[model samples]
Target chain A: MFEIFSYSFMPRAFLVGNLVAVALGMVLGVYPVYLAIIVSVLAAIGVEKLRVDYKDYAELSLAVILSSALGLMTVLVSLSRSNSSIFSYLFGSISLVTPEDLWVIFPISIFIVGGVLVFYYGFFYLSFNEEEAHMAGIPVKLLNNFFMVMVAITISFSMRIVGGLLVASMLILLVATALRIAKSFRDTIIYSIILGIFSVNSGLFISFYVDLASGGTIILSNIIIFILVVLYQFLRDKIRTKRFHYLTSFRR
Target chain B: MNPAIEICNLSFGYQKNLLLQEVNLTINKGDFVAFIGPNGSGKSTLLKLILNTLKPKKGEIKLLGVPNFRFTDWTKVRYISQKVREFNDSFPATVKELIASNMYHQMGFLKLVTPKLSKRIDQSLEMVGLSKCRNEQIGNLSGGQQQRVFIARTLVKEPEIILLDEPLVGIDQKTQHEIQQILIKLNQKLGTTIVMISHNLESIKGQSNKIFLFKDMDVFNYTAKEFTVHLSKKGEWVVNNSYV
Candidate 1:
């Protein structure tokens, strides 16, 4: 790893890594994952604040955040002049994850899971009706901020394994598929967790044998599951409707 | 006896123009009050201020003898906003789930709903005549049914005081009547103090004991008969700035 300093392009990473280590509590020196969590959480707070300020034009705030983030990434990528590094960040390289990353990831995972469990009803209530939740003593603003922070932490940590571009698939696609089959909120949560774990494990298994990109393979697995679920729901609903009509006509 | 709600010299406005000016008011316990006002008459704003959702530019509000800002017992004071109309109908929760959500403070964190709590939820649903639709998706209900579901959601708390902002809007007359009956029952039987903002004065005429007419950045207290006579005359009185 030290021999890379001889390369012309290595100085940028070395200089910035040292600078970030000095500025962000020396976490960048031992583990860069902490820096990502801090940056993502700051961005989450910024986005959430903008959302509150421009509540009437919420999509506009999201657009601004998205474009600014992409622009910054482009600028950083150009400055570093490293195509491989950008590719790893975009599609994820499992080999790049260090054991030190696990130390940070494990506790954050528990925090996210525990936070969700504790505030489950609050989240559900706030999603349905915010003012009513507030009046009912739900601490709407605090819970919302906590939830955003939790999501930010999850996305940042997940990016190390799932890549930046495909992280949303890890978060949303499984839940979307589960929603189609779930009868209740509890069912949705259970199904999504099962789908998420299954997709990721199977994606890793297939990638090892086929020599495929782990993140892309995982997202592809999710897509396949989602498509199959969609087809299943469509066929089931069609059959139910047909049977209902057949029975009604026969009785008539 | 302390007033259920007390406002003393409260002034509120939006930058340079005052909507409510040094308003002092009181609602005795168990009194069914109606806030009858015109569009942009600051009725909803007054409700928001009373609920402490909006910071008053000046003055104080007391609920059940406790100062508004220091009051932490919010489960005892329920508020149903006009925002119920803007609720996402596609939200995936059943009527029972929605109603049970209000009892979260009672349920404690990370704990499952108990059988007793579930029974209370069923009772609230039954009160709103939605026990049959307990498992139905709240979003799939009719506007009237959704309103009643929200009422059940509020009722589940068994609140001491319920502040409503146009609870009867956009629903059928029958549903509005049903909601009115529920409010009346809550007030008469349980002695729950009711403060509601309504555009339909006729519906609240016999229901509400006292009516507060919001006009010209001031609040005036009136009996039902005085309000009707005043409405007939249409602001032709040359009276003093007396609140009552």
Candidate 2:
């Protein structure tokens, strides 16, 4: 047993490892999933701001960022000369989260959630009508910059959890599912967060039992939920239409 | 009495092309002023300047006796843009929620909504005849009803002056007439000042008290009665006054 578990920091590692695993299993299991959401939201806002400010050069920002990230990644991969595949970095691996990563993720999660709550009204107003928001005397530029910075910080901190490839789907898929049945903006946001929590927990459970990739499982679960929501909406509409036709025919 | 809006020798341009030059105008309190011009004639640009969305190349604009740049009392004035309906149709909000959002700035960030504010929302919705549909999703409403909801949103701010940019663009005739009556009532009964940019001069003939006709990068201000005579003389009346 000692030979199998042999490592330089064995005693400290065992204690920390048990604590970390327990925390990850209990609460932090969903942290990485939420990180994916934060990253995607940041990207969406960045793209929207770019489109608004530089209409002609709207796509240029994403192009530049993607190229720079890719170039740096290539350089790092070449220099490291590691046998490990890049797929883990791109799609994320649950086992890759270190103690240092948790320290970064914890504060960032608080900041992202707190910042969104504080600026919720301003974001809602601006997203609906920018010109009217300006006329209403909301500090449009300041609010916009603050939101962008929050998004950037969130993305930077969260990329390790869900990976760059699957982040957008985690953020948008649950929100889209929530929108189908939500009657109000507040309800939509609440439902999305609820759905997100459900997806992360369920995905983690499935991943552990079935021995599948955690990030991919989470995304697949969200997609499945979204499809179910869509089908429910379709069936409800169909039933309502049928009932309406039946009543009208009987009255006639 | 001082003018509600004062523009002094204002000049605005985009890049190298000048849109308006040496445009001087004054709009008084409780006055309904209609701005009429062809497309690309800077009608919306001038309104944007008054609203301080765009800066003038030279000269100054004063709103309610305060310089546009220095003006901060936004609750006193409301603006409705041409692209008001361009907001995402699928945005999950009811008519009341949409109107209540406009009050958030006034109520301060993160402050709980009070009963007084709730009453105000109900009153504004009632004023726009959308009280019954206050709970309905905004996306489910018709185009005309959506426009009215926006108008109610503006009204909830209790603005003394309302700036409207083509509020009647895509609505049907009956809804258009209803909106015209609503504006007329707001102006006459509540003493609200209205500055509107419109192409439908015929609908505004007897409704608006003043008209600002943009021609050749200059604005010619006239009483509605005076502009009617001027248009008839220039044969421009034939194009716009076909309904009349």
**Best DockQ among the predictions, by candidate number:** 2
Q: Interface RMSD (C-alpha) of each candidate?
A: 7.3, 8.8
Candidate 2, residue A6: Cα displacement in angstroms equals 50
Candidate 2: segments with Cα more than 4 A from true spot: A1-53, A83-89, A95-107, A131-135, A148-164, A244-252, B8-24, B37-42, B52-60, B109-116, B215-244
DockQ of 2: 0.46
RMSD of 1: 7.9
User: Which tens-of-lDDT digit does each residue in A1-252 have in candidate 1?
Assistant: 111111222222222222232233232233446666666666666666776788676655566666666565555555554345555655776887888878877887898888878877777777776666766677877776787677667766666677766776677788778877765566777899999999999998999899999999999999999999889889999999999999999786
Q: Kindly provide the TM-score of model 1 when superposed on the true structure, using C-alpha atoms.
A: 0.78
* Candidate 1, superposed: residue stretches over 4 Å from native: A1-31, A53-86, A93-105, A130-137, A209-211, A240-252, B7-25, B53-62, B66-72, B107-116, B215-244
Per-residue CA lDDT of model 2 for A81-130, tens digit only, reads 44253455456567777887788678878977877677676666766666
Worst 10 residues of 2 chain B by lDDT: B235-244
